[model samples]
Every structure is written in structure tokens, then in C-alpha cells.
Target: MAATEHLLRQGSFPAFFGIVAIATLVIRYLYPDLFSQSPISKLPYVGTHVGLPIQKKISFMTNARKLLRDGYRKFHIYRTETALGQCVFLSRDSMVELLKKPDEVINFEKVVIKDFECKLTKLASSEPIVPHTIRSDLTPGLVRIIPRVAIEVARTIDNELPATDSWTAHNIYDKLLRIVAISAGSAFLGPESCHSEEWIQSAVGYTIDVVTGAVILKLFPSFLRPLAAKFVPAIKRVDRHRAGISRMMVPIIRERKEKANTPGYEKPDDMLQWMLDKAPEYGIENDEEMAYVQLGVGLVSIHSTTSTATQALYDLAARPEYFQPLRDEIAKALQESGGDFTKDSLYSCKLLDSFMKESQRMSPISMVIGKRILEEDVQLSNGVFLPKGTLVASPAEAVGNDPAHFENPDEFDGYRFYRLRQKGGLQGNLNQMVTANKQNLAFGYGKHACPGRFFAVAEIKLIVAHILLNYDIELADKSVGRYPNKFHGDACTPDTSKQLLFRKRLSGQSEI
Candidate 1:
């Protein structure tokens, strides 16, 4: 028995050595530079040659600040190579110049969105057509319906606040995401599906998963993403959600198609109907294809809207003093309009509008905007010449935070734009705010400047007004840090992990 045990122990060492030797050989062959005396190699657990700890540790926040400093002081232009061997980055003036030549220098949706295609096959394949269709068909419907949809969504939020007499602490991020998802879904699919728990959850999950997956895929080489996506938990989840969305939308598309063909059929008041009406123009006559288009819309609108709404909610909950002013503006407008939450009523709530605008300024989804490939040699007013196929964008966050434009730019002044308007100045001047500009570049600029901005603004205002008028909100933990400014190179998103708490305000306790 002793001899048998000794033999087994002796055999184990050879097997372990063989595995280690093979791993070392592979690492030496694949990544010799990584094993070199680079700054990254000095870090513990990452000293080995095989893994990618160095790049992984370059947090989005760090990269963003570095880019900002470089663009502002040293280089005045930022450049980086994308995984696909395309040179990508921004020049400060290139963004402004691109706007002037929209036809010649268009947003390269394919390069900007290459990561998304790994999981969303349809979005990957349908390049210029998808954006064109969105601009033509989807945007118009969104603008027309946003005001009414916003009011309905706001009312739902008002009714659903957690039951509490006093200011209660809860995770505002979680609650806000749910509200945004429901609101966006209402706008996209109508109230019937929007209010349903299953649909709302599915939409939110799919959006988060897909966006996360896209970012992850973008970090890796192109050839590896397909293999990596299947193994990555987030990408796998996105694929499942895509399948779920496809299943959910198919029947709705079929029903709409069947009704559309029938003469004198009553028009359904929803996005599905709008798509059906415009599909023929785009040669998308089939029900299945139209349904896929709807799915894409859902992904874009839901994700962007939800993230913005959540950010706004976080700002509101964190600053209790601003809540009253916002509520006062909303109430006065509602009272003036006979308590009707109509388009005019929403427009009249200028303070709410200003608050949302300010929140977006401080926490935009991206620090840079107007990404375009140089179709030819382009000269900027600043005397920089960009070569063909070079990517360009404005430093929106730095511009927004610049003292020359905004007074006390770092401080969260909710009435920042309202004060500007009170001074009889132009409200959305790109030169003044971080993201708006002849150069500000938030929703973009020129013809391609998000055609849906009007709709998005109206929707957010109504939702915020509804929440403040009814619910009493506050933070769950006073010690926890407020939402961090999310950074992904130049792109930003509201901090998702942050949380806030809320409770329903009692009748007769309406402070506003």
C-alpha cells in the first residue's frame, strides 16, 4: 500500500510539470512583449505573459481623463486604433467641421456600432439602411406621440411609488430603470405591453445585456468576438433576450399586417402601426422583417431613454432642495392648463425642461459626439487637416464643463439653463453648454442631430414632473457615494450600480 501511494504521488508531479511547461511555451509564443519589462508587468498576478491585465486595468474613467488632457493641452487631437485596424478617435475642431458637411461626412454607424453586430445580427448587417429608416419612419412617430406617452408614463410612476408617509430611502437607480423601461416600452409598443411585467423586464434586460455585450466585444479582436460572445455571460444573456424579443414582437407584427391589408381597417395608435405604414416604402413588406425593425427600435429607444431617466432621477433624489422648485413649476403649469397633461402643459413647465437639460449637461451619455469618417481631406477653421477615413468628434463633456461658457460648471445647478433663458439668451447654444453647440454635439448636429430630440425631451419632462408631484424621494444611504460619472473612452452612461430610495407623498403634504 505504501509503495502504491508513493508511485501515485511521483506521477502527479510529472503531469503538473508537463501542463506548466506547455502553458509557458504558449504564453512565450503568443505574447513576448507582455512578458517584457513594461509598466503593466510589474503588477502582481498580472506579471505572467499570457493574460491581458494591463489593458483590462485601463478603466474607462482613466482613459477618458487622459484623452481629455491630450485633446485639450498637448496634441489637440486624440487617435486610437480600433480592433478592426481602423484608426479611430477625435479632433476638437473636426466635430464642428463634420456637421457642416453632413452629406459628405456622415456618422459611420457601422464602425461606431461594430461591437453590437456580434450579438444582434440584424443590426450588424443592415447598416446605412437601419439608420436611414430610423430617421425617416421611427423618428417621426416618436416625435408625434412622445407628449401623450410621457404623461401616461408619468401618471403610472406617480401611482406606483412605494407606500410611505415620510421620505424613505430606497435604491433610486433600480426604481428609475424600471420606470424608464416601462415608459419607453409604452412609447414603443403601447400601454398594453408596456405595463406588463414580463415585457418590461424583458426589454430592460435585453437592452442592458446587449449594450454590455457590445462594449465587451469591442474590447477584443474582431475574429475572437463570435467565439467569446458565446462564452461571455452578458453576451449569452443578450442572445437569449433577442430571441425573447423576436418571439414577443412576431405576433404583434402579424396582427398589424393582417389588419393593414384589410380595407377600411381602424388604425391602431402605436409604433407598430407607424412601422407597418412605412415598411412598404423601405421594401420591408414582410411581417417578420417589420417585426425585426420594431425590435431594433425598442433596443435603441429603451436603452438611451432609460439611462437618461435614471440619471435625472438620481440627481433629483440626491438634491432635495431642487425638488420643490421643479414641483412648483410643474404644478403651476398643470393648474394653468386645468390639470390636463397635454403637449402645451408640458411645454409650459420650463423649469422641468431646464432641470432635465442641466442633468443631461452634467451627465451626458457621451463626452464626444459627431463621429464621422473623413470622405476626403477636410480642413478645419483651426487649421488642422484630417486625412481620409479619420474619425472625428467634439469633446462635449470638457466643453460643457468649461468655465468660459458655464459659470460654476462643475456644480449641479438645476436652473442653469433657466437662468440663461431668463437673461434672454439662446437656450441650447452649443458653445455655451458642454453638449450643445454649433459645436456642443450632444444629440449630434446638423441634419442628423437626433431628429427625435423634441420627443425625448418632452417624454423626460412629463415623467419627472409626475414623479415629483406625487412621490417623496431621498437616498437610501447617506454615506454611499452619489452616481459616478460613467466613462467608456469618450462615451458615458449614468452609473447603474448606484441606488436611491423613495416613498409616496401623502395628500395635503404636497410641498410644492
Candidate 2:
């Protein structure tokens, strides 16, 4: 009678309800087919299913690489549940199969926009003006862009890095990210605004805010997300950045519009002009909307470019053996182009290209690329049925490291692609860092593959070339190998906290 009284006292009515609530969630997680009504319940998920949602999410976030490899090895197609919901992972061989499907069947933009939580964050709605402008105007205008971007890159490098022959500790990721943002600002925002500290802050802050806000908002229940978005610091900061961008861009957009058709007016050569030129057909009616579109574009470009460049630098520093050859390639390219880093000159640095590609293969931006949300239920050629509203992706990282795709894939052979290029013909064409084949998904694949990849490759090459030409870099802690990568979910990024030792090259070729 005394023991029963103690048990009853410990398990009060409130505690009982709490226990019951947790038990229900656990049961739902464990026996999804019976307890959950979601369509994706039937799909096989990565990791153990007999845990609470938070535990599964934690595993997904922290151990994505291991889970991805295990899933890729065991099943042809499977799902992984995270804060983003259940994302179905397809084998690397599914690239060709996915390529056969039109955007109508497997939508790309929808997944991106959803992941960004554009509705709550007010980051950007669907805007064709961004990609359309990038594809049509910005790409063909690389002749103009390469020179302008190079100028900012040179200037930013000089400004951000200390001029010293002695080794100096620097947070290379922050320096590199800042350099990328400021330099990309020139091509994306224009020369007038690129130097503005306000624009740079807004551009960089907005990308971070969108990501932070989305992650935060995902933590709340769907019904409470709207309220949470209003109060969330990052979500609120996103609006501030959006408003500032509008204030900065409206007058410029208006001026561009007014001068657009004037007889003697030569349009400004930048992404803003390109977007404004193509806005009407894409239904971009207001100046503010155009500014948001620019933010959206910056969001896509800056982070990936920064991460790619950072990883390549880390790799170069860790394996300092590649430095002399890369420097030689840069020097040769510069000499051939009369010391200007043009599109052709940058592309001609095939060794640097190979190095960056190798770096990317070893550490891609994400374990899985070609992420898409299904528009309608579809079956793969191998007869894997995917339901509508299911998220899907290809295991590009696994493919990059696969022996069948790359010989001795685990080894960081910087000259791998460069040597492959010497083989000539179709193999050489596909080996280019910008070219996205089944084996190379750094820029993804199919019609929806990164439109900015050509520019991205150029930008990465330009930055790396400048660094090689200007500075000798290595891990700040001389004893360390490549700084460890920070993984969150499927995303793999170079560690920003680790510092690198940068010493100005005393006798290097002139800056690009």
C-alpha cells in the first residue's frame, strides 16, 4: 500500500499526460504505417526507425555521411528523415534516368524555394528573372564580367589580407567568404554598390539569415511557424536586410529603367541591368521584387563559391606539393593573356581546374546533389516508385568517391582531371570542372544544373589563381592535416573556425 502510494504521487496527472504524449510520438515514429497517415510512411528510411523524431533528426544532422554511404550500399532507393522531412536518396546511376524527366515531373525550383522558407522569411518567391538573366545575359557577357570580377578580387585580397612576408594567422574561410561576396558584388550588384559596406553586409547577412531563419522556423510546429517567424531574431533580420536592399536598389532600378530606351544611353553592364532588362516577361513588376531577386541570386552564388574556394585552398595548403605546379600554370596563363585574367586565360589553367575539381570530389558542397521535390508520382527505369510530394536526390558524393567512376578515388590526385584531359575527345570535354556529367555532379546535372557554373568556375579559378600568385598558405597549426570539415545534414563545408598561415609571396608574378 505504501509503494503504490509513492508511485501514484510520482506520476501525477500532468506527468501522466506528458508521458502519454511522448509515448504516442514514439509509437508513431516506430510504427509509422499503423500510427501515421503520411504517404511517405511506407518508404524505407535511413537509420533506425524505432526512436523519437528528435533522435532521428540528430542522427541525420550529425552522421549524414555515414548514413548516406550505408544507405547507398544497402538500398537502391531509400529515404532519410530530417528537419526537412523525408528525402528519398537515389543511386548515382539514376542521374541518366532523372535527366530523362522534365521539370514538370521532378521540380527543382520548388524544393529550393521550400527549403528556403521564402513564405515565412520573405526571402524570395519564384522568380525566373534571376536564372533567366544569369543564363542569357550574364553568361555571354563573361568577357565583361571576368575582368570586373578580377578587379574586385585583386582589390579585396589586398584590402583583407595583411601585406607580410612572415607567416600570419588568418581565418581563411571568413577572408575567402568576404572576398567572394565583395568580388561577386561587382558582377551581381555593380561597381558603384560593390564597395558599399552596407550592400556587402546585407548580401552576406541575408544569406546567413535565410538559412538560420529556416532552421529555426522548422523547429516549431507548422501551425506555430508564422508566429515563430515574426519573433525569431534571424527571421526578423532577414526583413531588415530585404528592406535595406530595396532602399539601396530602388533608385538604381528606376534610373536604369528611365535610361533604358534613351538614344545615347549605353546600359550598365551588371546583373541588375540584366535582370531589369528581362523582368517584364518574367512578371517582375516592382523594383523591390527585382532587389529580392538579386538577393536570391547572391544567396545561391556566394555560399557555394566561398565553400568551394575554401575547400580547394585547404586542400592546397594541406598538400603543399601542388602549389608550385598550380603557380606555374597561373603564371603561364597570365603571361599568355598579357597578365589579365580573362575567361580564356583562366580556363587555360587546366592544372588549377583539376586541383579544384579534385578538391570538390573529395569534399563536395553536399553529399547528395540534384535535390528535387516530386511534382507527381513517378517510377524510375528500375521500377522504384516515388510518390508525389516526396523529396528526392542523387548521391553525387558517393559517385565522386566510387572506384568505378574515378580510379583510386580516395586519393586526392590534383592532376587527375588534368591527366584525363590529355586523353582528348569526349572524355576531355566532360572532365572540365564546369561540365556536369554522371560522374561529376559538382554543378549538378540535367537542364536544371547550376546555370551559374561557368561563371562560378571562372570565379573560383580567379580567386585561387590570385591566392596562388599572391600568398603561400598552410595550416596555422603546423602539425595539422587539412582542417576537418563541418557537416550539417548532407551539407559539407570547410571549417571556418580553423585559421591558416598566409605569407605574402615576395617575388610572385603581378596580381591578376
After superposition on all C-alphas, the RMSD of every candidate to the true structure, in Å, is 8.8, 4.3
Local distance difference test, candidate 1: 0.63
Tens-digit per-residue lDDT, 1-512, candidate 2: 56545657887667666766997876776766577666556666778566666777778888888888878767757778765776888887776687568889888777766777878988655667777788898899999789889988988988999768799999988888789888988998788787776787788889999999998887777888999888899988988898988888888889888988899999888998877877778887988888778788878888889989999988989998888888888888888999888999988888899889999999999888888888888877877777888888877777687777788988889999999998999878889999977768778776767899999889888888888888888888757678878888889989888888888886754444
Worst 10 residues of 1 by lDDT: 40-49
Q: All candidates' lDDT scores?
A: 0.63, 0.82
Candidate 1 Cα outliers beyond 4 Å, as residue runs: 1-61, 73-75, 80-93, 115-122, 125-147, 158-160, 261-264, 425-436, 506-512
Q: How well does candidate 1 match the true structure in TM-score terms?
A: 0.79
